[model samples]
Target: MADNAPAPPPLYDNTPTISEKEDPSALPPELAGPCSDQAQVTEEEGVASDIADKEELPLPPDPVETVTVTVMESQLLQKELPAQENPVAVEAEEPKLGEETELKQKQKLGQALQSLKEESNNVSDLTESDQKALLELKQLIEEALNEFSFSSPPEKEKNLAGTLAVEVSIWGIPLLKDDRSDVILLKFLRARDFKVKDAFTMFKNTSHWRKSFGIDLLIDEDLGDDLEKVVFMHEHDKEGHPVCYNVYGEFQNKELYEKTFGDDEKRAKFLRWRVQFLEKSIRKLDFSPGGVNTIFQVSDLKNSPGLGKHELRQATKQSLQVLQDNYPEFVAKQVFINVPWWYLAFYSVISPFLTQRTRSKFVFASPARSAETLFKYIPPERVPVQYGGLSVDPCDCNPEFTISDPATDMTIKPGTKQIVEIIIYEKCIIVWELRVVGWEVTCGAEFVPSTEGGYTVIINKAKKMTPADEPVVHGSFAVSELGKLLLTVDNPTLKKKKLLYRFKVKPLGD
Candidate 1:
């Protein structure tokens, strides 16, 4: 090691020495090189002094005196710089219960944080206020689940979950109709179930109802009438058994009611039904029979109208008298007599005998065969509320006939002696037999038949025959007409022909 080392401090006092002022730069060329960059430094300036102190070091490194020894120092940095070994891994980290508890808590805390983050992420799309509102709503719904309900439903009954109520109306009503066109009417009734369908069917089916003329039929050209208001007489029984009977045209005419019932109290009741059915006098009549007596009255009559009051009264009396004559006891007891019409509504009331005064008797007389029979069979009833009789004549009184015989000839004529003639429309055979003392004469007289309305006979020519028109026989005069048969017979001998004539004839028409 070279031991020659001496350094002096910078001297600056008074007007400091040039050497001192010059500092190290003034000392040697080698040292000046180091101080040259500080040439503007002043002596008292700390900045120059700082430069001077740095220049005091030797300009050259001492070579021979220094031994160059190379040394490497490595400190294993046992400095334990807060140990890079994770505190979690140190000393095998024997987990203290509290530490373990703390670790679990920390792990739980991490999971909670992670869960919170996930929930936050899920709600991130909502505004902050909306998220808060949704959370509150959820809480409210949860609270509601635990509260009581004012109108709570019971636990659902199995198999009956939804159906809970029903409404009912118009359950039972009966419908009646006639059989002639029942199926068409039934189709109408079903179609009427729907308002839309019903309107269409009513318009289409108007023709079926239009045939009704008063009680005979029910129909209206306009669609205003109610279906229920249209009356129908059920032609069949409830079980669909058809009632078999002739519904005569006369039965449907109002005139028949007048003819059958006349002005009797029973007639009033019958009229009441007629009015109730349609609120007017029977413009048309419809009848159903109750008994044989009623049938007898109607069976023989034609169904024409215009029967006058007097005519109706006479007919009713005759019909009642016939019934009474046939069944006196029945009339006395007021046993129901069958009439042409059905039972009147009032029959149910005034039935059975009331008293002798009001009690009614009916008699039925056999049909008249001759003028005498007509007189005997026609009479007023033995007991009566009213007295009247019926006779078959254009005039009020019945006709009379007389037979006169003189000497051997007999003249038979009507009471008025009117000649009646019948014109034969077709060819027919006619035989007239005159029974006188039980013998018929052959070619005994000439005959003349009238041209007016009856046959007028003039007996003129007389002839005697060997075999007379007698015994199971008669004088047969065959008349072929569209031509004429004339007979003129004058009894010139003035012999009385007491004759009882019986004629049999047949008219053949094709």
Candidate 2:
């Protein structure tokens, strides 16, 4: 470490874990995330499953493949045949509920959302009514704090050796007297329609649950290391909310499924790991009234297991119950990618029953539309490569550029050619990283001089690249003369392809 360099943020010693830029690894902020996510596509919504290394499923099966969720689980799990018979999910139009179930589902869904407020960023801009509710809730919490009604967090010795704290806090903000406390309270209020008594009760329960669950100590516990890829906090979305990706498809593997849900003990451990990851991720939020106090949740369901896994289904129910009861409105939006056709049908039916604001927070994308749907809210470079983007996990590695190196993507029409040009005015070496997702095209590069009659130099000869080639192309060229670099892509196939590239000019040797 450099003598004058800022030390890595303290490892949550005296303070509660908190940071808008928290490192993804368990280590301090100086070190970042895991090498690779070990994630794969989820194809179960009605699309075909990866029958390729199909091992006999360890758990027994039920008659039908059903994807069902109570109001508490990731909304995407609500897709009610869930079979892949129609395969219309690949079409542009989404499915509405079955005619028979539409009206009935609507009323039930309405009841589910009847009390919750619409999703809003304007917690600071409260109405007179909202203000009154906020004040009432604060008083309730203050009184509880005064009386020490909430139990103290358990397992204090596990925390960094420090003095005990008298004040109770969630996500590091004190229950009273802190501006950010209002934001935390508002989440509970909005989750329960600003009903003070219900919000207060919910708050008490959360505090009690945290102590009983040993959340403070869980942060320091080493759950299954393999679970890291199942859910992880990575880069932020365009709006600055940290992005957490849930790849439940990992559970499809027999060994992993057994390890996570094989017995009651393993299931208990899995639940702890799930909650611990959420706590770690939540601590990274900025809870100030005006800060981004929420996260963007992306759950990839391509190969996610069906309901037949009774143990998993039961475990999921428990986890969702805990989240719905305690976590409240920390999720800004829940996006389910690679959704099967049935999920669309069910979501479309219930959407009308949800408040427009609440409905907006739930997004569903079919397999074909998954990558593009994610791109709408998260930049392609910030997206993981497994989902058809330029950003790689720490394992594949990005040597020439970091996330700060801006990159843009474009689509190439089938059977056409595209040329990209970059003008240079000084002596420098231009280095670039480029990738064509699922590439099967011919590409060439060259430089044209600015001076009249100056000769052009060919950088890379036009060569045919295939889907079997490396996912990204890294290149550089030295130019002592004023010139422009031209990179070309010729697509000979019938399908459109996405191209991403970025460059930076480096002066001659340091």
Q: Which consecutive 10 residues in model 2 have the weakest lDDT in total?
A: 1-10
lDDT for each residue of candidate 1 in 1-510, tens digit (9 for 90 to 100): 000000010111111112322222221110010001101111100111122122222222112111111111112111222211211111244776745874775586455334322111133554665445434433432332233111123522223544222211000111111221222222223223323334233523332222221222222222221211112222221112211111122333455444435566644433223223321111131211111111101011112122233433333333332222111110001111111111111222333423322222111111111111111211111101011112112342212211110011223211111111223333544433332322222233333333457564433244332223332223444444343332222222222222233233344331
Residue 54 in model 2: lDDT: 30
TM-score of 2: 0.71
The C-alpha TM-scores of every prediction are 0.16, 0.71
**After superposition, candidate 1 runs with Cα above 4 Å error:** 1-415, 431-476, 480-504, 507-510
Model 2 pairs whose backbones collide: 35-395, 42-302, 42-303, 43-302, 43-303, 45-340, 46-84
- Alpha carbon lDDT of each predicted model: 0.23, 0.61
Model 1: how large is the Cα RMSD against the reference? 72.3
Clashes of 2: 7
All candidates: CA RMSD (Å): 72.3, 16.7
* lDDT (Cα, 0-100) at 294 in candidate 1: 11
lDDT of 2 at 131: 87
